[model samples]
Target chain A: MKTTNKIITNINQVSVDQVGIGDRVSRITARSVKNEAKIQGLKMALNMIDLTTLEGADTVNKVKQLCYKGMHLHDAYPDLPTVAAICVYPNFVGLAKEQLKGSGINVASVATAFPSGNSSLEVKITDTKMALDAGADEVDMVISRGKFHQGEYNYVFDEIAKIKETCGKNVRLKTILETGELGSLDNVRKASDIAMYAGSDFIKTSTGKISPAATLPVTLVMLEAIKDYYYETGIQIGMKPAGGISNSKLALHYLMLVKETLGDKWLTNQWFRFGASSLANDILMQLEKQRTGNYQSKDYFSKD
Target chain B: MYIGGKFPRTESGRYFTLKNAKGEEIANMCKGSRKDFRNAVVEARKAFEPWSNKTAYNRSQILYRIAEMLEGRKAQFIDELMQMGSTKKQADEEVFTSIDRLIYYAGWADKYQQISSSVNPVSGAFFNFTVLEPTGVVTAIAPEENGLIGLVSVIAPIIVSGNSCIVLASESKALCSVSFAEVINSSDVPGGVINILTGNAEELIPHFSTHMDVNSMLYCGDDKKSIQLIKENSAINLKRIVIKKDIDWMKDEAESPYFITKFTEVKTTWHPIEKIGASGSGY
Candidate 1:
């Protein structure tokens, strides 16, 4: 109830218990309008990416080439590289499901108190079930970093347990620690332990909301945690360092980190994933050079 | 001016160094002078036909797309501003304002002809009409205080109405201005419609303001001696001079007159609409 005023007035933190002046309302109005355009652009951009092939062309001609090449690859490589699943909010689980049918790729949707994970158990569990029922094969859920910081380790562990229980057979659970806010390598390691011990199929690095998500050091710490957990429990947890990675060199660096840290089992698309807006093209750019034996212009593949 | 994706820089690659706010050399900008300005004017003079002949709505669409591109690269602009030593808040505001300026010009491109009075009453049977037209190529000295926004404010208005400009970059900060030129070049803004330069205003502006071929001179310099030189130089060609103190484009829509006054070439076509009565009556 207090937040309505702050959201309406936009005076710093909405959660604060202070009365904001009318002057602040303009700031709020301006911010909301600004956010509207950005949100629309992001939604449209995401919808246009054909994630099944991860073959994006910057121009119309590139699109044609990609189309022909995709078909040829489909026919020839019959067992070609599988793209990571399409990620979306719970509402779009069905949409991802519909678009990716008979395509052998998985559909991943964030559920169970995503980003913040600041909600009741009933709500989180219900959200995960809905995503799975709507045909999400991989459900990425965020852990409550706030609770974890507040020494509510058991509470965080219980939430992941409920999600893992709900995931059942065909579905997998990715418990996100949001390491950016979680603070240090030690915090990341502990959070990784909690998620794996409670039976997460994978441990994710962020909600893509925080500033410091998915750094190599943070990810490296997480991989070490995953390896240690595997040595003790024999249950291998997957890793997805999603957010802000814009190219292939960074992805390759992350790949190198994973292979060195966890060894061969983590190399497959089943275990390793990079979440980003520009990472696909960077990967494809590398693939192009490898396939064609020449380096292309930085703008050769559209950065769009 | 070639009207394509590529705009030829002035024939002279001659340029001057631009400093950041900290007085460090950032870039050597393409320093165009009054001579280069005259050349750009000549190019724009040649280009005025096909560009102005196009429908207003089409011009407006092109301007709007320029705004979109600016919006997409707002972060990049801010980063450049930071490189040129502006704070984050100031950089962000300048970038956003630059984009808004494009939107402002976009709204005016089609409707600029309608916003003023054109009716004239004559005592005789002869009819007279007054419509705004481009004066010719504009010779502008862009403001130095607000880096990118001020630069766009001065340049966009002049070009939106089909006039072209020879804009001197800011004395210290020129990265954003040159970056803007790159954006305009990519946006298909007809070459010579905007020619950017970075150099000593005193050395370059004399030739620019005094050039007989240039139709006008826009001064951002408020100092008395500089103003005198600009005014004195204009005496040679009678260039329409818009002084700094006179224009406060920050508060209002400022693109219309800046352009209409510089680019429009007025020429009336006359034909006899009357026919001799009962002559050639085939009925």
Candidate 2:
């Protein structure tokens, strides 16, 4: 979709009802999913994960291990689905790409000065180019929070548009708003609108480096933006709530929110993704517990 | 009731009639299910770190506070015991003994490590010492006969060493268990440190044994089938199993530092020693 002057002008008028969103989220969380439906939700949440290892201490061995874990979540449990992607820093994109080959799992690499978009446009472009050249299937770029906070909405829009241009049509580009740094639900909605209009295939919640990475209310605001965007344009943008969602029950709650907000079309991994690392094992543990009539320990699952 | 520091009904919403020895209904107790046991284990695991990291002196203070709270509510416990068909003298003795047992374990809380841990001599130039650490979450079945005393006897020793526990109260004699839980709640004891559940041992034993998050299993009865089931399921995670079969809770032998040692693990650390001189004068 084209970024028109009309869209930029409409961004300011988009305000969120904080109390209403909170009430809606509470109602959604109160709905329980049990038994067979719970198992199915657990599996769906597992498949939606982008098993991530984005750390300064991350190494080739760690990335490779994470990729392996993404493919084979738990071998003992039959018919377990693999994770959708393996997320890592730009440097390990090629290694993750190689490790995930033929397994049908995508390799997602964080780019554009990820976690903190403090770099220049030239450096951000190089960062995206580096991951793309390494054959990263998806590029997760961070929005310039400094510029956005300064009310430079045009700069943020132009930056995402430029990165989307660099990615072209084949490669999907996910825009990380780093919602923790965005300050409020209003800013989150504004940023979500900017990213979608500027050609972000998916709008993500956080970089996972911030304290309050992904919260229910912030995600709900972003989902409402996605819904509004889908209505405006025929195109559909994915929603990804990354970081701090480490348990199966919370993950299931996220799935419930997504379903209630955006409907069934966005339930698949193609449209929804969890930018998390430890969340995979928790979901695996829940699945194993269901398979065997016993609660599982973290010792049994692989730590990636 | 009293799972995770708060009094909550069983998630299963099922209750069983508690009858007196004369076959008269006394109360309807929660028939705690596996899911309740699971939730209690989750709470116990959450409480383990903070509870175990508390100073030994603080743990002792908490245990002593529990004893004090029980002493304050002694008449209520005696009344519950009588309602459960105990003689007035027997009820009095049981409540007093339960209070005393808590005090006994309270005194041993900070001192057990001194008697149990040791510095060992090794061939290598290393200072090797073995210290006792509280095993994580423990699941215990309180003895069936002495409701208050058995519950106190099993819980005091296990928790004195900083371990958190989820205890299934005696099925037939459970009224005192709930009353004791009220005393514990009023005590300075942290929630989840001692979660008491009223349920059948036969129904909850398998879950108590199989829960992987539980570090140890303590059984207070002599049922061969239940003991064998605990033994077999404990192998799944190699959880430490302590079976107190054929033991009389009223005897002094029931309250021992050795009981505290059963729920603790020995962690030996080897620190390299630097030789001072050829004669190793620093040693």
Report the first chain's TM-score for all candidates: 0.72, 0.98
What are the runs in model 1 whose C-alpha is more than 4 Å off? A1-82, A289-304, B1-283
lDDT, candidate 1, B1-283, per-residue tens: 1222344454566766766667888776665544455455556566656666667787788788878888888888999989888889878877887888888888888777776425455443344566766676677788876668778888777777766677777767777876777778778676656777666677777667655556777887577888998888787556788786555545464545545444454544333324434665332
Which clashing pairs does model 1 show? Answer: B133-B264, B134-B263, B134-B264, B135-B262, B135-B263, B135-B264, B136-B262
Candidate maximizing DockQ: 2
TM-score of each candidate structure, all chains considered together: 0.43, 0.91
RMSD of candidates 1 onward, in order:
19.0, 2.8
Error of 2 at B169 (Å): 1.1
Candidate 2: DockQ?
0.71
Question: Residue B190 of model 1: what lDDT?
Answer: 69
Worst 10 residues of 2 chain B by lDDT: B274-283
True contacts kept of 1: 0.00
